[model samples]
Target: MCFRKKLWSIVLSAALVLGTAIMPANMIFAASDNESQLQAMAVKSGTLQYGDSFKWTLDSKGTLKITGKGFLYLSLDDLGDIKNDIKKVVIGSGAKEIHFSFWSFSGDASLPKLAEISIPLTTKVLSGSLRECENLSVVTGGKNVEDIQGRVFEGTKWCQSTEHVVLGKTYIAYNGTGKNVVVPEGTVAVSEAAFQSNKTIEAVTLPVSVKKIGSYAFKDCSSLKKIHGGSSVTLIDYDAFLRTPWLDSLNETTMLGKVLMKYKATAKDYTVSEKVTQIYEGAFSKCDNLESVTIKGKITEIPRRAFENCTSLKKITMPNTVTNIAYGAFDHCSALAKISLPSRLKKIETGAFIFCRSLQNVQVNGGKTNTKLQSIEDAAFAGCNNLKTLTIPWGVTTIGDYAYGYTDGGGDENSERDMVQKMMWGDEESVPKLNAANIIGISQSLGHYYAKENGIKFTATKKGSALKKPTVMINNSGELSISKVVGATGYEVYDKSPYDKHWCKAGTVKAPVRKYMTYELKGYKYKVRAYRETSTGGYQYSAFSKIKTTK
Candidate 1:
C-alpha cells in the first residue's frame, strides 16, 4: 500500500507540468529520404499541444519527448515499411498515461517506430489503457483507475522498479521491472504472463477487487519484496515469482488463503484471502520460510502438490467448508508441526501428506459418510519419521498404499519401530470453532509417524480370534491362484467401489481394499493371481480376496 501514496501523488503532479519542450517555432514539416513526411502529433484537452505548430522529420533515431496535458493521438500509417523510426517516446507531467491512448494506423506496427513509448502519469482515469503497447516502459496510476489489461507496459524502462509501481484496477498485466504497483478496488483480474523477467521490481499490491493472476506474471524480478494480496486476489500464477530471492523476507498473511500459487523460492509466508474458494497445483510448492495459514471459508478443492515442500510451515488452520485434497498436497513439509482437516473432507489424493517428517498431530472432524469418506489415496503419509498421532475421522472408505510411513531405520532391520499409532484417537470435541472464519479451528493436536509402510495404528474391538494379543492389521486375504487373461496385461479386484482397481503384476500384488468388515490380529491371507500391464501402464489385478478379518 505504501506504493499507492507515492504513485498517485506523482500522477497528480503530472497533470500540472505537461511541457518542457515546445515546437521550435520555425520548424516545418519535411519529407524523409524514403519519401515519408513528418507531421506534428495532435495534443488534446488537458494534454499539452506541441509539434502541432509545425512538423519535424525523423531522419535519425533518438528519444522523442511528447509534452502534453491530457492525451495525444498519433496516426502512423504513412510510416511505410520502415522497420523502425521512433526509438523512444517519453511523456512528461501533469499528464496521465491514459491521455496518450492511440491506435496503430498501420498493420503490424508493433513497438518503437511506434515501439518504445513511455506515458508518465498525470490524471486519474478509470483504468490504465496501455494494451498491446509491448514497448512501453513505465505505467503508474491514480486513486481512481480500476484495472489494466495484460502486457500494457513491457520492454520499457519505467516498470523497472518493481518495488515502486502503483496500480489500481483489474485485468492488468505489467513488466516485472516497474516500481511498486497497487491494484485498487473494483478490479477483477491480473492476466497471465503480465510481468515476466523483470529485474528491478520492488513490490506489488492487490486490493480486494482482484480475483486472479496469470501464470509467471512476476517471475525473475530480483528486487521484489512484498506482495499484499490480503482477501483480495484469488488466482495466482503457479510460477509467478519463480526465482526471486527477496520473497524469503516478505510478510505473507491470511490474504493468500486459497488464492496462493507458489513455486521454488518465492512461496514464503504468502497468505491467501479469507474468502478464497480454491487452491490449485503447485500452490506454495517450495517455500521454506512459510510459518502459518488460516483457511477461512468454503475452500472446495486443494489440488495435487499444493503444499509440496513448505519446510517451515509450523501450523495450518482449515475451515469446515473444505471437501477434497489432491495428491501430494503436503509432500515434503519436514518442519510442519500441526495440521487440521475439515470435518467433511471426502477425498484425499495420492501422496497428499507424504514425507512430513516432523508432523506432531492431526485433527479430523466428523461429517463423514460411509461411502463418501471411504477412500484415502496412495502414499498419503509416506516418509513421516516423527508423526505421533492422527484422529481418523469416521466414514473412511479407503486407506491406500503406504498409509503410514517409515522411519530412518537406523540401518537395523529389527530397529524399534515408531509408536505413532498409539496417539491417533480423540480430537472430535477438542478442536474449537474459529470466529468469522466459517468454522476455522485454531488450536490443533500433534502427532508423529515413522517413515515406513506399517500402515496406520489403531485397535479393533475383539470379535473372536483363535488367539488374542495386541495386533495391528490390514487386508484379509484368502488363498487364491490365478493366470493372466489372454488380451489383458493386468487386472483389478472389484468390491464395488467407484474407483477402478489398479493393475497388478502377472505374479501378484495386494488387492486394493474399499470395505473393512473387521480388523487386527486376524490370520495372514495370501493369494496368487495373473495380470498384465494396461495402456495406462502397470500390471493388471486379480479378483477380490474372499477372506474377511475378525478380531
Candidate 2:
C-alpha cells in the first residue's frame, strides 16, 4: 500500500467497520499489492507513461487506445501543458480499472469516454462518466482500490458524474455530479470544487464512506434536489449546495423527520439532522420556497450569506452552539419575519441582515460583536422598504453603506431610493447604531463608498432586486406545456406531476412565467401580474396578464 493510503486506512476506520463484505472478494483479493497483481492486466496503448524518467504524455491525435495495464498512471506532472487535440482517451483491453492511480490529469478535450468502467462485484454499465464532459471524463482507482489521496482525480472525467458511482475505501476522488447519483460504499473525502457547475444532477445518495465534503463541492448544481444522506457524513464544504433547488430534501420529511437541504418535491414537512456540524456560505442560497429551517446540531458557526435571498422562508432557528456569523448571511429573506440566533453569539459580519426587510424579529443584543460592521454591499436592503426596526448586537464596529438605506415595506422603490450605498463595518467596540427609525431611501453615493470595501455587499450598479420570480402553468393545451401562473411558487405535486415527487421539497416562492401549474379558471382568463402587498401588510394583486391563457 502507498504511504498516504496507509494513513487513510487509519483515519476512516468506522467506514471499515462494515468489513469488505459490502465489496466483492475479487476486489479484496486483487488489492494484494499495486504492482505484481496489476502488471499482467496491461493491454499496450498508443500512449504510454511508465517508470521514473519513463517519459510523460503520448500524442494519440484524438483517440488514445489502451491495450493492457500494469498500473499505468498518465503522468501529467512531467508533461507541462499539452494541446487539446487528444480528445478521446480509451482505456480497455483487459486493463480492468487498476491501471489508473492518484494524480490530476487535464488536456483540451480528454477522453469523454466511460464505456469501460465497472466495480469488482460486476455491475454492467454501457456508459461510465458520460454526462456533461462537454468533452471530458475522469476515471480513477478501481472498485477494489482503497485509500487513494483525496485529490488524486480532482477535476477530470473521474470527477464529473451525473449518476451513482461506486468506490472502495481505496478509491480517492469523487468530485463530479448529475441530477440523481448514488455513491457506493467505502468512499471517503469528497474534495473541493469537485462538483462545481454540474447543473443537471437532481438527487445524490452519499455512501457511509464519506467523512468530509470540501468547499463548493456541490456549487452551482441548480437542479439538485434529493440526497440519500449517510450518518457517517461530517464536514461539509462552503456553498456546497449553492443555487441547488433540491436542497430541502436533506431536511427530514414531515412524517419522516429528515433534513431537507434543497427543496424540490412532494413532502409537507422537513427537518435537518443534528450530526451536521456546519452550514457553509450560501449553503441554501436562492432556495426561495424554504418555509422554515431548524438546525439541530452542534454547529459552532454560520458563514456568509448562509441563507441569503431565501424569499419564501418564514423562519429559522440557529443552534446555541454557534459563535461566528459572516456577512450577508441572510440579506434578502423577504418573508423571514423571525430568526432564532443564540444570545451566546460572538461576531456578526457586515450586512449580515442588510436587506432582510421582512425580518420582523431577530433577538440580537444592542452591542455584541467582535468586529465593526464592514462595508454594506449595494442594495443590501434596497427593495426592503418594509423593514421596521433595527436591533444592533453589542461589540459592533463598522456598518455598510446600505446598512439602513431603503425603508419602504411596500410599493416600487423609486430610482433615487434604489441607488446603492457602501458602509464598511467600522472598527468600533461600541455598537452605536441608528434604526430605520423612519428613514427610507438608498442613495447612489452611499452605494459607491459603502461598496468600495471588500467583503461587504457588492451589488452591481444594475437594479437586480427589482426582478421577481415568475409563475408558470402547464395546461393540457399542448403535450405537456408550461405556462406562467401569477402567484404559485412551488407545488410539491407528488403524484399529480410527471416524475416521482417523493423527493423532499423546501418550497419555490414563485412559479415561472407559463411553465407547469394547473389552472382552474373556467373561462381560461390568464392574469399574470406581480403580486404586490398593501401598506396594511396584506397582498395587493397586480394588473391582470396582458394575454389571456393560450388557446
Candidate 3:
C-alpha cells in the first residue's frame, strides 16, 4: 500500500506539472450491478448525508469515502454507530471542500483503532478539531489543507512519532526524542500540544516563518532545555511552554516571540529586546527581586496584567513607541519610586499603575502639547500614597474614577491630599510647607480643569521662589532639629534611609525664628536632609546630611 501510494503521488505530481488530464485516484463509484454486488458482499455499508449538502459511503473496509461531488461535510456524530468502526478513510479527490467540527472525530474510544486517514488536498480543519486521539496514526493526503487547527492530531501516534509531522505546509508536531531538534523552515505555525508531555527532547529551534504558537504547545516537555530562532513569531499563547524546564532560564528573551506571555526570569534588571513589539498578559508578574526594567521595544500596547505585582521593580524606562498602556500593566509595583512616560503615550488603562505605594514622581513630556494622550482610566494612579509630583501632559482629556488624587478606598477616606497633609503638618492645624504639595505639571490643560473642579491643587510649576538649603542637627531637648537656611521663608525636613527605605517628608519649619525648629523623634538610623522652601513654593536643598542615629 505504501509503494502504491508513493507511485501514485509521483504520477499525480508529474501529471499536474505536465498539464496532462490524469484520472483521479483508483476508486470511482459508478452505478452498476457490480457495485450492487460489492455492497451485498460488504460487512457494513451505508450512505450518510447531511441533507443535500454532503454525503459519504461507509464500506466494510472502514473507509468512509466521499461519494458526493464538489464538497462534503464529514461530521462524526452524523455517521451512525458504524462511525466507531471506521479504521481508515479515503476522501475522494473530486471533493474540493471538507469542513470538520469539534465533534467530527473526537472522544470515541474506538478512535484509537483508526489506523489511517486520507483527507482531501483541499480540506480545511477548523480549530478545536480531532483533539486527544491517543493512538490513531498515519494521516495521509491533504497536500493543500490550509487552515489545520492546533491539537488536530494531539495524543495520536502521528503526533507522538519520532518524526516531524508536516500537515500540508505547516510543521505542526515534532515527537522526535532527540536531544536537539530543528524545525523545518517555511513552517508558519507550531500547533497546540505538538510536543506535549514529552520527556526526552532537550532543545528545539523554530524557523522564522512561524508566526503563531498555539496554547500549551509544549505544555509538559520536562527536559526541553533550549528554544532557538523564531524571531518572527508574533503571538505566543500563555502557558505555551508551561511546566517546561526551559522557561525560567530563557536568557535570549526575544526568541520567545514579539509578545512575551510568561516570564519566570529571576534577573534583577531585565531589559527587553528591541524586537519585542508587545508584552502580553502576566508576562512579568510576581518578580520579587526585579529592581528595574528598560523596555526599548516598539511595544504599542502593554497587555493586561503584563507586569502586575512586581513588588521590587523600582524604575521603568518607557520608549516613545508605547502608545497605550493597558489595564493593570504595572499594578502594585511597590518599589517603583519614579517613572518617565514616553511622549507618544496615548491612554492609561484602568489600574495601570495602581497601588504603587512608593511612587513619588511621574514625569511626562510637558512640551509635547500635541501628544496622543486621551484618557486616564479609573484608579489608574490610585493607591499611590507617596506620589509627590505628577506632570500631566497637556493633551490629557479625560480622567476616570479616582484616577489620581485618591488612594485605596474611595470618598476621601484614603485621599492622597489628606495623607500628605497629615505627613507634613502632623495634623491639619500646623501651617503647611510648599514642598508638601504635589507639583501638578509643567504645563497643563484638562488636568488643571479637572483639578479645579475636584478642588485638587495643581500648578504648572512650583509655587514659590527657590530658597537656600537648611542644616540638620539634633537639638538639646532630644528632638530632631532643622536649622533654618539664611533667606529662606520655611524649611522641609526629609528622612532618607534605605533601612526604612524611601525619602519621606517628616516635618516642616517656618524660618526667621532664632532657634532651630525641632521635633520629638522615633529612633531609627536615618540620613536626614533639610530643603528650604521658598515663600513662593519652589524648593532648594544642599547635599544630604550625614547619617545619624536618633537618640
Candidate 4:
C-alpha cells in the first residue's frame, strides 16, 4: 500500500514554538508586513529589516541572504508567494542559530520550488525539521555546522543526484540508482521516511555499526530485492518497509529490536523468541490455521488488536510478565477453547476477548482476597457464549459496560444462561462500581439493586446456591453419565464437537436423581459434557465438566 507522506503546517506562534517572543504574529508575512517594501528592495536595494533583530536581503539572481541573528525563526512560509522567486539560501557567519519547524511550501504540489541551501559551520538545524524540496542538489559548506536533523532534504530530486550515499549525521537517503549499494560503517540511525517511495536499487549492504531503522525508511521500494546487513540493527519503527516486495521473502520470523513486528508462517505451532519484550499491533492477526502459541518473554502488555480474527487459534500460553491486555487484543478468535491469564495481570481493556465462540474457561488469580486484577473494560468478555467458569478477582474495582453479558436481543436460551449461570466472586462493595445501564444477561442475575435501579433487565432471580463443576464418564454400555453433584435442581447434557460451536442438548437430569444420571446415545463416537443446575427457582448452572468420549 502507498502510504501518504505526513504534512506539517507552517503556522507558527511565539507560544507554540518557544515561550514568549517579540516577532510577527503570523507564520507567513501578509501584505501589511511590508510587501511593497520587500518588492522594491528586490528590485532596487538588496537589504530590508525584519523587525529590529535581523536583516534580510535578496540578490538579482534570486539568492536570499540572512545576515545577523541571535535565534532566527525562518520558516519557508515566511517567504509566502515570493518563495518561488528565491533559488538559493545563504546563511552568513553572523548568524548564531537557525531553527525551522515547518517545510510544506504551498502551490500545485506541497514541496518548495527553491534549490540549494548554504549554511555556515556555527548554525544548527533543530530536530523534527522536514524539508521536501525535490530539486535541491547543492547542499554544501557545513563543515562546522552542528548536527543536522534526519529527513532534512527528503523527497528531493537530489536523492538520486549522486552515486555516493548521502547521510545527515546518522540518517541515510539519496542511496543512488545503483543495483547494489553499500553503507559505510559507524552509522547509528536511519531517520523516519528517509528512503520513502524509492522504486530502484536491487540490493544493499550495511555495516555492523548501524542501529535504529526509522518508520517507512524503505517504503515503496518495489525493485529492491534484499537487505544484506542488519546484525547490529535494533528499534525498527512501524512500516519500515511497508510496501516492499521483500516482505514476501520473510518466512519464520520478522523481528526488529525487542518488538516482534510480524509473523507469517504456515506452521500449526509457533513460539515467540525469549528476547521479545513487545508485540506490535496486528502482528499475528488473521492467522486462520494457528493452533498453539507459546510466549516465553518479558512482555508487559499485549497491544491493541494484536491477535484479532485468528479463527483457528485454540491454545495460548502467556508468561507471567504480562500485566495489561489492550483493547481488541484477541477478538473474534473462534476456536480458542480456554486461556490461563497470567497471574500478575492487572487490566483487561475493552473488547479484549469479544466474540470468541468456543472460549470455555479463563483462569485468573481467583478468590475474594488481594487479587491483581483491577479493571475489566466494556465487553471484555462479551459474546463469549461458551465461557462457563470465571473468577472475578477481589482487586477489581472498575468494570465497564456489558463486561460479562449478552447484547440486547441476542443469544439463545443456552447462550443467555451461559452469562446468568456462571459463578462470580468479588468483594461486595467493589463490584457495585460496574456500570449497570450497559449490562444485560449476566449482570442482571447478580441482582445488585444498583444494576436494576440503573435500568438493567433480567428474568432470573438474584439469590442462588453455587454448585461445583460436575464430572462425566462413559460407562461399559456406551452410555454417558455425570457424577459428583452437590446442590442441584436439574442438569443440561451437551454433545462435544470439534468444529461446531453450539453444544447439542441431549437430555436433562431432574432433582432426586441417582448418584449417576445415564443418557443412552445413538452411538457414533464423540465426546459429551454437562452442566448441573445449582439454584432451586433461579437460572444458575455450573461449568461444563471434563469431556467423556464413547469408545
When 2 and 4 are scored with lDDT, the better candidate is 4
Off by over 4 Å in 1: 1-187, 200-208, 226-231, 235-237, 251-317, 326-340, 356-371, 385-408, 411-551
Candidate 2: which stretches are off by over 4 Å? 1-185, 195-205, 218-229, 239-260, 263-295, 301-316, 324-329, 332-340, 344-351, 358-394, 405-417, 420-551
Q: Is candidate 2 or candidate 3 better by lDDT?
A: 3
TM-scores, in order shown? 0.36, 0.37, 0.45, 0.45
lDDT of 3 at 248: 57
lDDT of all predictions: 0.47, 0.45, 0.64, 0.61
- Model 3 over residues 374-482: C-alpha lDDT tens digits? 6787668867767755666545545665577665333243454564444333242331222333536433244654565445678765323333344556755746556
Give candidates' CA RMSD values in order: 22.0, 22.5, 23.5, 22.6
Model 4 residue runs over 4 Å out of place are: 1-100, 103-129, 132-152, 155-165, 253-270, 277-289, 299-309, 315-331, 337-354, 359-551
lDDT of 1 by residue, 250-271 (tens): 3443236345443334444544
Higher-lDDT candidate of 1 and 3 = 3
Tens digit of per-residue lDDT, candidate 2, span 74-96 = 43332224423345444443443
TM-score of model 3 vs. true structure:
0.45
